[model samples]
Target: MHVHNSTRQLSLNEELTMSKKLIALCACPMGLAHTFMAAQALEEAAVEAGYEVKIETQGADGIQNRLTAQDIAEATIIIHSVAVTPEDNERFESRDVYEITLQDAIKNAAGIIKEIEEMIASEQQ
Candidate 1:
C-alpha cells in the first residue's frame, strides 16, 4: 500500500510539472474596466484549456499581480492584451508572446488560447 501511494504521488507531481504555464499582461489607456475584464477573461479561458495561468493587470491603481522572474521563466507563452504598452514589457523580450487589443481579449479569449495551443503543437511537430 505504501508503494502504491508513492506511485500515485509521483504521478501527481508529473502531471503538475507537465501542465503548460501561461502568463498574461493586461492594460488599457484608461486602465480601469478593460484591463481587469480582459485579465478575467484570459484566466477563465486558460483554466478551461488546462493551462496554469498568471495575469498581471496594469490598471488605474498601477500594476497588480506582478509577474516574477520565476513565473516568466516557467511560462510557455505570454499574452499581452493592452491598449497602451504595459510597464516592464521588456521582461518578456525573450519569450513567445501573443499580443492583442483589450477588446479582443475580452471578447475572444478562448479563441486566443486555442491559437496559442495550436502554435505550441505545431512547434512540437
Candidate 2:
C-alpha cells in the first residue's frame, strides 16, 4: 500500500511538472449547452489535477478564443468533447489528444485527467 501510494504521488508530481499551460478546444454539434459544459468540466478537472489549462469553445457564435498553434504545441494534451466532428484536430498536430463525449467530459472528468496523465507518462517511457 505504501509503495502504491508513493507511485501515485510520484505520478501526480510528474503530471504537474509536465502539465505546463495545457490548452483544449471544445465543441458540439449544436454548440449550445454541451460545448460550454464540457469546457468548464475540463478546465475544472485540469485545475484540480494541478494543470494550468485554457479552453476554447466553438458555439453558434463561432469559435471563441480559438486556441493558437502555439497553445496546442505547448499543451501536454488535448481533449475533444464534441458530439459531431471536431474542427480543432489540426491545432494539436502530433500532441496527445483524447476524443470523448460531452457527457463523459462532465461525468468522468477525473478519469479524463488520469487518462491524459497516463498518456504523458507513457510517452515519456
| Best-matching candidate per lDDT | 1
What's the lDDT for residue 35 in model 1?
A: 94
Local error of candidate 2 at residue 41 (angstroms):
0.6
Candidate 1 per-residue lDDT over residues 1-125, each given as its tens digit: 00001111224455467558889999999898999999999999989888899999999999999999889777766788888877888887666678888888899999988877786578556
> Per-prediction count of colliding residue pairs?
0, 0
lDDT of 2 by residue, 12-118 (tens): 55556654665767788789988998898889988988878888888888989888876765566667777776664555546556777789887888787787777
RMSD of each: 10.5, 7.9
Question: Largest TM-score belongs to which candidate?
Answer: 1
| Number of residue pairs clashing in candidate 2, backbone atoms closer than 3 angstroms, sequence gap of 3 or more or interchain | 0
Q: Score each candidate by Cα lDDT.
A: 0.80, 0.72
